[model samples]
Target: MNPTSHHQGSQRCGLDALGQFDEIVDVRTPAEYADDHIPGALNAPVLSNEERVLIGTMYAQESPFKATRLGAALVARHIAEYLETIFADRPRGWRPLIYCWRGGKRSGSMTAWFNLIGWKARQLDGGYKTWRRHVIDTLAERPAGLDCVVLTGPTGSGKTRLLQSLGAAGAQILDLEGLARHRGSLLGALPDRPQPSQRGFESALLQAIEALDPARPVFVEAESRRIGQLSLPETLLRAMHAGRCVRVRAALPQRIAFLLQDYAHLFEAPDDFGRTLERLIGLHSRQTIRDWQALIAAGRRAELFQALVETHYDPAYRRSSDSHYAGLDQAMTFDYDPTADDGHAQARALIAQLRVPA
Candidate 1:
């Protein structure tokens, strides 16, 4: 086997270096890989879910020597199969970065085989644990010199639309709701897609944040700590809370019109919509929920949306902004017409308003 390559400090093995290899391989079990692995890393588990469990049980109930021998036999069989299939197509110069849970036996065994087969394979010094630490540390500390411009407004005010517009117009934006696969409300879950696991969400968040330039302001929507089931990183929340705010203002009628179109899927499944509204039972009166359900059943969508905005969303928005966001009363107001405007023009004007005076 070629000499094993190792990093001196796992923490110092920044993502930049990890990106150099042709492939990043996670040789842990499928379940472990599913929990979370390095972003873009491919799963090629040396020990499968069942095999890992069997090895563990043997290690505990029997002796380490017997467990090692059994694990070796299984691993050898798996590797031989892989070589004839997955690795068979690989060229001689192919290079891969391999890791298991703790950079232990599973990955080491694979690395040894790959090297013997004339491929350069480097083992991640501390494996997934190191990458996890990097993610936590990166999120815990806000990017240096980063300034945020948070878009604040009541539900259905088109904050998400305007945020998208700003990004297309060249402003850096962190689309938290998009990343979380959530709309950030009780009725926010998408009709077709499920929200990502919390770990998956964080991995995406870190990757998105890392891609932006810290010298420029990142436009983000004002949000509660939690989005659907995932919570924003604490440092990110604090940064947004301390950032300058812009309150998007849209007339109530326009907001109602926008919601009817934006949330058209909810109307398609009235039962699901009504069941979702039931989550607000403790927050609103029983009679109020009954009325909302009555409207859903009757297909009085516009009226239902209007009532929800006035009774539930608007009140909660005011309380959240008033408490969490500093300097909200003095925030710049962006009057929006979601019905007529496609947001590009508004985005340009908003950018002009945000420009610092020379």
Candidate 2:
């Protein structure tokens, strides 16, 4: 079921009606809000951190009635404060759509309060959940008429970093790894951090793409639909498969050094490193993986990287390359030691050339 419009007064704003709203605010808890939120939402929570806990504990351990009274008291206090301080002398017919975690009492109460003040306020029937689903559905599927430039390279080729650098050079680029927060690999997971729910990931991607100029070319890292724990939206995967690929080839030593430097935190946390290595091992044959594990046990990190690239990583690259349409990946080999200024200059020239038809 859709997450919007459960009540009569609530407005059902799907992807289409989202544009009509003047402001969208998320009033969920800070932890919930931080995981990922509406692209431009203001976080004005009704409950303070401790007050929410007090209410939750009441609901969980005591009784729903006790929790209800406590929640109502807090909500009323905050709502009045907001109306007086934030929404004072608001424009006529000031329509506001308010939402909390489940489109329940918190949002419903706000809707009624605003209605009493002559504002056409509505509760989000499904709250943030509906918006999250909308975001995932849109990004997972491809929209029409978007040309893509996919950056193809082995792990630690600095694809994510390069995308940012290219964006700095005024090239429209999509930094998918940054959005997912997974870095798109077994080693990509940061310590104690889980990837966003698939729905959250889609919302972020759609927001990013919409901000770019559709008429201009877009640069993104070439990746499979799945990036670590999360999966790409189906639409985006198809778009990438059909897009032109730019092969960014670097030397083995450079890639190893880059990984060590970029992922220094992984080394600091033994559990993250061990878990990442264990997962990678399951993807390969027992002997090959065991051999790699042996290198790690012996503390030969660089050698382990070189072996994986020559055996696993390089083979995967060749297979992906072979399946492309004719002349799909126009190769651009860079020096193992690319000065920052030179890399930017080369990337800019390539992007401009990509803007022109072959």
| Model 1, residue pairs in steric clash | none
Candidate 2, 1-358: lDDT as tens digits:
3433234534434434555566676777777777777778766678877888999999999999989998999989988898888778678766666778877887778777777878776666577877776775656454445677777777767777677778878888888888888777656775666778766677777888778777777887887767787877666666666777776666667787877677667656544465466666656777776787777767777787788778877777777633552336455543323224466766666666666321
lDDT of each: 0.85, 0.70
TM-scores of the candidates are 0.90, 0.74
Candidate 2's TM-score reads 0.74
lDDT of 1 at 80: 90
Superposition error at 329 for model 1 (Å) = 3.0
Please give the lDDT score at residue 33 for candidate 1.
Answer: 88
Candidate closest to the true structure, highest TM-score: 1
User: In model 2, what are the clashing residue pairs, if there are any?
Assistant: 3-126, 140-233, 140-234, 140-235, 141-235, 142-235
